[model samples]
Target: MTLPDTPEQTPLTADTVLRYHLCWKHRDLDGVMALYHPDIQYHDFFQNRVLGFDELRDYVRASLPHAAGEDIVHSDRIRVDGCTAFIQYQVTVQGGDGLVAFQSSEAITVKDGLIWRINEYATLVRRNAKGSDRSSPRPATSRLGLSPRQLSTMAQDLEHYFQRQRPYLDPELDLQQVAEASGYSRNQISYLLNQVLGQSFYRYVNQARLQHLLASLDDSCTRMPVDDLAFAAGFNSLSAFYKCFREHTGLSPKAYVKQISLRART
Candidate 1:
């Protein structure tokens, strides 16, 4: 797995790579996306270039259905340069007629400490392996028996939902609503957010709302009142808003707003 020749750089360790792989296997999109640079440019194997955060978000969302719950496996690092690295892997997805479709020789490019692009040059290694059945029963309870691939798909879907719908604005939003929006059930959503991601539903929603409020404060043209902004960000009460704001940003809403205003002035 020789990386392209580039300037000398520190390569990410195997442990780091394994950790990232587990995060992906866990279908933690937010966890995965946090690794990439904000201004990433993704080049697909089909020569499609996805530019910017929003574009990457959409591209990933659209690709999820095809890749979810597949037998994806990654191999050792090929090479690394400053802020860039590469890895090789193979993936097997269930195909029509109960066949196992294998894709080999996949390559991934990580830039600025995140996966910037993936170029898969693959062929079907084998087909029709035993026990390659695709059909499975959906979980009866809230917990979806989602493989890593399915969770990855759900995570991507949730990311798009967050960007487009801005569900964080409803402080009362719960696992059921989020599950409905993300096409999972209440139990599955609860398990993903609570067990997998290690965060409660309310905490996750509050964090998202706080982040939304922070972004709103960054807007130059909008001068929103604190109380209105709090409600708009989906905080049920002023006190809760204040408490969450302070906890998340380590500053009161007023102070955070003032800081943003000051930063904007500079």
Candidate 2:
């Protein structure tokens, strides 16, 4: 709860929060720390974390946009009421072409010219949900203590890891191996894949495998059978491979190959 202040405190609260926002935009750690009240508490509802001053340094550092062109888009202008200010924004998950994003809001309470408390809430915007014809944001859960911004970074990192390492090419690969190699805990990776990306771990891996196989099929000189290529691309079973392939290409493997051959002949 915030200390009660009259309308006279509105200007001060707005100024302080504007500065805090600029500090975050510029990736200024010390500037952000300077604005925080020593007894400040940051509550992240999405991750269920309640952080203090000392803990906030690392949290803020991880959240600040270190690189230009971060995906955060402000949904509304800052609105201040007495001693508290409100900010709302959305962070688009990377590597999905903006198909997925999280809507986040922050309620900052100012006290004695510094930030006293924060109540942060975020929800994952689902592009598609089972048994529903429409999409919407849901109450996201994360025990891994990752903020929405950090989850966006995690998405980018996972995509980069898949592209550069080609780990999906290993038929024996599992979520645990990815968690270990990617420098994240299984729960963290799982949260990113399931909560934010809206896909199971195995489904993500199979999608990568399918992409790999399709890329190989583009080579006219390649002569491997489709089933063999599927196994080589890390599918453990033919049925699984065919299902993934058809889901992606909307055609049977033989028909897809025939179409590619037709295009080449033309």
Candidate 3:
């Protein structure tokens, strides 16, 4: 007796399947979403089947935020027909509290240039020896893993960069420039800001400028007007300066100055 082939055997074209995989790997939710029909249905290893556009949209929004690094090893494709395709791939994710190493399998189904469904099966693989096993543990590098000399160098570079570049005025100040100037990679900069500094890039730059502004305010010899002082402090706009100033100092710039003036008189 001869056994029949499995229903999971689906034929897919190379071009269509490669495009789907590219979109997924790039984390382009919009591109991936566009590949799905309005009435698409999808199922994952979680035993949940998402149906319709709204449900899929919400699911993607909620899940994408948790997605981190991707290390995919192999991806292959087959076309069942002109309208249907399947792709199989192995992916590794950083696990541990600091995102270490976890491996998984992903299967994507595309129909008529849209993703009809996706099935992913992920399993915990290994933990980093230096990283925490907690869900949201900071990276080991942030815990002073570097030598004392290296730490001192990094701190000195960070301070000097802030003083020299004055990145606050440039809204486009990004990790690449900072890393290059500090002799670090973009990943190193990101790790420094996220893990060591415990702040986002925008917040870190703004806080540094805000501190400088506060110091300047304490010196009466500087005769620049309040608005001019704000701009000179690297704030691009008066409104943004006032907003961040209030947030950092718990008082408007004018109010803070008045309080300082009154205190000095007393």
Give the winner by lDDT.
2
Candidates by lDDT, descending order: 2, 1, 3
Task: TM-score winner between 1 and 2, please give it.
Answer: 2
Clashing residue pairs in all predictions, respectively, total 5, 0, 12
Weakest 10 consecutive residues, lDDT, candidate 1? 134-143
Q: Which has the better lDDT: candidate 2, or candidate 3?
A: 2
Error of 3 at 175 (Å): 2.9
Report the C-alpha lDDT of model 2 over 1-266, residue by residue, as the tens digit: 54768899999999999999998888899999999999999998877889999999999887887577788899999999999999999888865423788888999999999999999987767554353323455635666778889888888778889999999999999999999999989988887877677678889999989989999999888899999999999999999999988888889999999999999899
What lDDT would each prediction earn against the true structure? 0.57, 0.86, 0.56
Residue 140 lDDT, candidate 3, scale 0-100: 47
Candidate closer to the true structure by lDDT (higher is better), 1 or 2: 2
Q: Candidates 1 and 3: which is better by lDDT?
A: 1
- lDDT per residue as tens, model 3, 1-266: 22122343334334556665676566677876776767566654422333467766655543442233434455444434443444444433321123332234545555554565565544333334464442324244332223211232354467667877776556556777777777777665665556544457766777776777888889988777788877777777777778888877788878999998999899
Deviation from native of the Cα of residue 254 in model 3, angstroms: 1.4
Give the winner by TM-score: 1 or 3.
Answer: 1
Local lDDT at 244 for model 1 = 79
Q: What would the TM-score be for candidate 1 when compared with the true structure?
A: 0.48
Show where candidate 2 strays beyond 4 Å: 1-8, 94-98, 129-140, 219-223, 261-266
Question: Model 3, residue 188: displacement in angstroms?
Answer: 0.7
